[model samples]
Target: MPLVHIDLIEGRNDSQIKGLVEDVTNAIVKNTGAPAEHVHIVLNEMKKDRYSVSGKLKSEEDQ
Candidate 1:
C-alpha cells in the first residue's frame, strides 16, 4: 500500500482536487508498482489564516 499526504491552503474546486489526487495516485502506482486501488491519499486543506510561511499567513500574503 502507498500512502500520500498533501496539505494546501483551501481554495481549489472539487474538480481540481480530484485531478490532483488522480495524478498523485498514478505517479505512485507507476513508480512503486502499487495498484491504483491500494494507493491511499489524504488531503489536508487549511484555511488561509491557519497556514503560514516566513512569518506571513497565507491570507496575509494575498493582501
Candidate 2:
C-alpha cells in the first residue's frame, strides 16, 4: 500500500480534485507496483489566511 498526501490552497472544484486523485493513484500504481485499490491519496486544503509565504498571507489581493 502507498499513502500519498497533497496540500494545496482551497478552492478547487470537485471535478479537478477527482481527476487529481485518479491521476495520482494511477501514478502510484505504475511506479510503485501498488494496486489501485491499495493506493491512498489524502488532500488537505488550507485557507488563504492560514497559509503564509515570505511573511505574507496568501490572498486574492496578493495576485
Candidate 3:
C-alpha cells in the first residue's frame, strides 16, 4: 500500500480535486507498481489565514 498526502489552499472545486486524486494515484501506480485499490491519497485543505510563508500569513499580499 502507498499513502500520499497533499496539502493546499482551501478553494479547489470538487472536479479539480477529483482529477488531482486520479492523476496522483495514476502516477503512483505507474511508478511504484502499486495497485489502484491499494493507493491512498489524503488531501488537506487549509484556510489562507492559517498558512504562512516568508514570515507572513498566506492571506497577506506578499504570499
Candidate 4:
C-alpha cells in the first residue's frame, strides 16, 4: 500500500480539489507501478491563520 499526503491552503472548490487528487493519484500510479486502487492520497487544508511563513502567519502577511 502506498500513501500520499498533500497540504494546502483551504480555498479550492470541489472540482479543483477533485482534479488535484486525481492527478496526484495518477502520478503515483504511473511512477510507482502501484495499482490505482492500492494508492492512497490524502489532502489536508488549513486556514491562512494556521499556515505561517517568514515568522508570520499567512493571514498576517497581507497586512
TM-score of each: 0.94, 0.91, 0.91, 0.89
What lDDT tens digits, residue by residue, belong to model 2 across residues 1-63?
Answer: 799999999999999999999999988988989889999888899999999888888984568
For residue 33, model 1's alpha carbon misses the true position, in angstroms, by: 0.5
Off by over 4 Å in 2: 60-63
Per-residue accuracy of model 4 over 1-63 as CA lDDT, tens digit each: 889899999989999999998998899899999899998888899999999988889998678
Pairwise lDDT winner, candidates 2 and 4: 4
List the global CA lDDT of all models.
0.93, 0.90, 0.93, 0.92
Candidate 1 similarity to native, TM-score: 0.94
Superposed by TM-score, candidate 2 places the C-alpha of residue 60 at a distance from the truth, in angstroms, of 5.7
Quantify how close model 4 is to the true structure by its C-alpha RMSD in Å.
1.1
Candidate 1 C-alpha lDDT tens digits along 1-63 = 888999988999999999999999999999999999999999999999998889988899778
What are the per-residue Cα lDDT tens digits for candidate 3 across 1-63? 999999999989999999999999999999999899999999999999999889988889644
Best-fitting candidate, measured by TM-score? 1
- Number of the candidate with higher TM-score, 1 or 3: 1
In angstroms, the error of model 1 at 62 is 2.8
